[model samples]
Target: MNEQPRNPDPEIGDAFYGFVASEPQLTWHDGTPRLYFKAGQEHYEYGPDGSRTKLPTTFHDVVAFRGAAVSGDETLSKLDWFVAHGRLEPNTNPNTGVETKEFIANRLGPDAARMNIEIGTPRRRSQMESPNRRQPARQVVFEPPEQDQPEHEQPTRAM
Candidate 1:
């Protein structure tokens, strides 16, 4: 029999609900594709009397890797609401000797239907570079995979 650990790290397996406060910057770090973004979540406090007070929005530095990073950045835009689940990582700035924290997004994405996001038509590189392009009337919808159903009935969730 396996026994669960009595005390676990509180920050592990944390979930964050917020809007992408900044554009996701994609870059190659040590030959690995990485996407970095800032997300902001509004804070609220509940008192003993059951009254809730709104507080300032707290910003989080988020990092995603490889496919998750690419898909997330491609599908999500700045100010788009998103829900992310991951572990918290703390690091120290080698140059400044200051400690910094970031959330490594294991799973992250935006809900197109809830966010009212319009999917633009695919365009060639030249067309994408041109400023006179017309907007497309396409949209994207997300459906969860039906694992319990037959293989034919399962919906693909790839973006």
Candidate 2:
């Protein structure tokens, strides 16, 4: 029997939802844009009776790179609720040798809790020809094919 070796190091990532605590600042590094901001993460405590209590919000430093940085700079404003998915990286100060963790976002976007979003179909090439082109028709109904239905209706079937 042959045994497969497992890798020792693995990548870890995290995501958090919070409100912007400060205005985003855009900077350039080696021709790449970087967006930096602070996020206020709310904390809550639940009692035995299911009562929820709000705690002091914790502030975190967040950075987005390149295209994500550009979009974040344009779309994010102070106090706006947003979500970020990324990994925590360590940054060490050259003068003090002190290290701190910063959230480096691979993806970031507005949180649905405070924003409305619509899903639309991709526009055809003709639609791109004009800046004033009318919006495409939206999908209103969905019908699954009958062939995909199981012979017997299970009470807890996965869709």
Candidate 3:
């Protein structure tokens, strides 16, 4: 088996912070659950006089698999703001040979503070589609891993 790094620089890993463009779609891919969504980021600038300006919004397709997909299906929506980190992947259409690009999220979640939201249970499909009585929404909150934070701001352990 051969293993090669797709991107040599870890700093260049795929990262995106933006608004979700649509409700996430959850489905099975190769028997592992997957979640897909589109996210849009609008560029802005502050002028010398403090005036704000907007630039064209950039959009990216984001896909989450496994545990990430499970969590996303519950809490993600078009109305939410999101942040994701993964890798840029390129694909070619088999029939036409046209190339397309996508970002597959290894870590993803809503920006609760930016969205002014309190944590709440995600409305999962399983609960919605089940013939039995619906279960109450389960609230879950996540904190970023220590390694993911800036070195200067990393939390310190008590002696």
Candidate 4:
């Protein structure tokens, strides 16, 4: 089979940070799970005197599929601040033939800028321990591999 080489700097999608404008709905489309929500994105203009003027919030329709749909349904709610990275696709209404854009999110998460978050220590399971009841799957956290540092240099933490 012929395949094309992957682009090193491929275009992913645009990112938007906003508050949830409506309650998220989880539905199934053609046997695939889908999550739908509206995001209210606010804009601001800064004046020369450092004063900021708030602009009207723009509402956008956002959708996520598969694993993202399940996670979003569990964590997202109305009025919650979130960040979504996705591409806009034209969605036309069959009855009206009106074209509208929908944000198809590949990634969705809480906006850290507007909230505080704590990274919990990962729970480890013992080889001998057996669970009496079925446990919910734990969310996996990815940690980058530690890079080798010079003997004279020590790692520092940012405050």
Candidate 5:
């Protein structure tokens, strides 16, 4: 039998609206890395007949390296079979794949090259460059290269 250690409640009290996620991409909040997932539950009631349901949105703050991603996939699960994998790199670019464009939390050091998080992702302090850079159209104002015209002699006959 395995026993888990009892953790104390936060000084500010517990949260009851959003769940603390542990689904990867854990991050830090104000320089502090929160390793634990603070979960909460809410009640949901069904239509006329009889049904009670609960819909939860867990909010977690795990610590990982934070940086500007070159690109990566969104919705990592959608990108491939997770197989309950513990390591999370999201295999794809946030700008191109299954990851959301919000923020990517990856491990420090380079075994890899880049990382990206799609929009709607989670983060306490995240930053990203605009994927779509508006290129200014090249305008060619043709001035004929300012060719020196041949010197024209005035007509000798001054009639």
Candidate 6:
């Protein structure tokens, strides 16, 4: 099978974040807050005497979500549009609604179609949604030498 060789560029990283919702408790429909982080970026503010104040630097994004009510869910669901054909979708039932946050992932590239998020993005769905109780144990396997080997074979390693 043909495959593109993996690029060794270490700068590549996820650019977008957030997830979808089923039934949100907020009044607004498009309330999802997508979050993103970049390196070496800073916030600039203009002071009174024509001086600019470049505060500390940290990864910032235009879609990153913030928590409300002091102590609630940190994940944002408003930005999780039912993305099809790489476009933002309108609010609707089953397809789109502000329920609880679902998943938060980062964009793969300029395509904005592919996303990668933390594995098992947790959801508050009932038992029917989540079934696995305990994770399975990890295991490794080893293969033996072929049967047609020489009788005087010393070991598994070939000289």
Per-residue lDDT of candidate 2, residues 38-152 (tens digit): 9999999999999999999999899999888987886777787898889889988689998888899988777766754322322222334565778898988989766776788
lDDT per residue as tens, model 5, 1-159: 988669967334221222223333434678644322222234576867786666653332322333411111122211121111122233344586764222223422111112244435432112444557686899978765777776996667866
| 3-83: candidate 1 lDDT, tens digit per residue | 988998766588878889999899988888898999998999999999999999898899999887887777777887888
Report the C-alpha lDDT of model 4 over 37-112, residue by residue, as the tens digit: 8889999999999999999889988999988788777666788788888888999868999888998888877665
Better of 1 and 5 by TM-score: 1
Model 6 over residues 64-85: C-alpha lDDT tens digits? 2333311112222332322211
lDDT of each: 0.79, 0.81, 0.79, 0.79, 0.33, 0.34
Model 1: residue 89 alpha-carbon error in angstroms: 0.8
TM-score against native, each model: 0.60, 0.63, 0.61, 0.65, 0.18, 0.20
Give the poorly placed runs of model 4, Cα more than 4 Å off: 1-7, 116-159
Tens digits of lDDT, candidate 3, 25-72? 999978998999888888999899999999899887788999888887
In candidate 3, which residue ranges exceed 4 Å CA deviation? 1-12, 93-96, 123-159
Question: How many pairs of residues collide in each model?
Answer: 0, 0, 1, 0, 28, 11
After superposing all C-alphas onto the true structure, candidate 4 shows an RMSD in angstroms of 12.9
lDDT of 4: 0.79
Clash-forming residue pairs, model 1: none
Model 1 segments more than 4 A misplaced: 1-12, 47-51, 112-114, 118-159
Model 1 Cα shift for residue 85 (angstroms): 1.5
Best by TM-score: 4
Q: What is the lDDT of residue 81 in candidate 3?
A: 83
The residue ranges of model 6 lying beyond 4 angstroms of the native Cα positions read: 1-26, 29-116, 123-136, 150-159
C-alpha displacement of 13 in model 6, angstroms? 23
